[model samples]
Target: MVLIGICKYSGGGMQLTKNPNSTDGLLDISYIKDLTLLTILNNIQSLFNGKITSHKLISTYKTSTLKINVLDNNKSYIQADGELIGSGDFLVSILPKAINFIIP
Candidate 1:
């Protein structure tokens, strides 16, 4: 299976999430202005042993729209924030500054 992680933050390449205490300025939202794509190739051994030797970094995309086309005949599961949203073809779009976060 292929695990693809498309995120707003470029957490220092493969780091994904950034460290709060780090002074690398990775916490800045400048990078979040766009999207970063990472594709990881997973196998049975990699899934069970927690090894990502075959993981591949796809590339960083400047566009806000993403289209995912599943070639499989079977239903493909699509998830967001750990919740299954839908299946099959997915059109992901990013709405910049669309939400107001009231951080306490």
Candidate 2:
């Protein structure tokens, strides 16, 4: 199953988009500039325990894309897509230079 845009909720709760390509790859740290990577990861972990499954890291010369696949027993496979937003040191340090996500 391919998850697309964030789900629509009329009341509360956060809406997370399933689409892998919906993101522009912009970290947009402007909102939480002070948040550390550990903090972010911890927060994300707490959101849904056992719900999140695999995370695919795709890197290019100057950009990295994270494809998060959520596991669902009712579904066959999960998929998402993202593109490069900017040049970063992480991308430059990774091997292979160019990367793409492929699920089989």
* Whole-model alpha-carbon lDDT for candidate 2: 0.30
The candidate maximizing lDDT is 1
List, residue by residue over 21-59, the lDDT tens digit for candidate 2: 313432211012244577548666532432222222211
Clashing pairs in 1: none
| C-alpha TM-scores of all predictions | 0.42, 0.21
Name the lDDT value of residue 49 in candidate 1. 39
Going through the candidates in order, what is the number of backbone clashes in each? 0, 7
lDDT comparing candidate 1 with the true structure:
0.40
Worst 10 residues of 2 by lDDT: 53-62
lDDT of 1 by residue, 9-69 (tens): 2223333322222222222111222223332233334323323232342222233555668
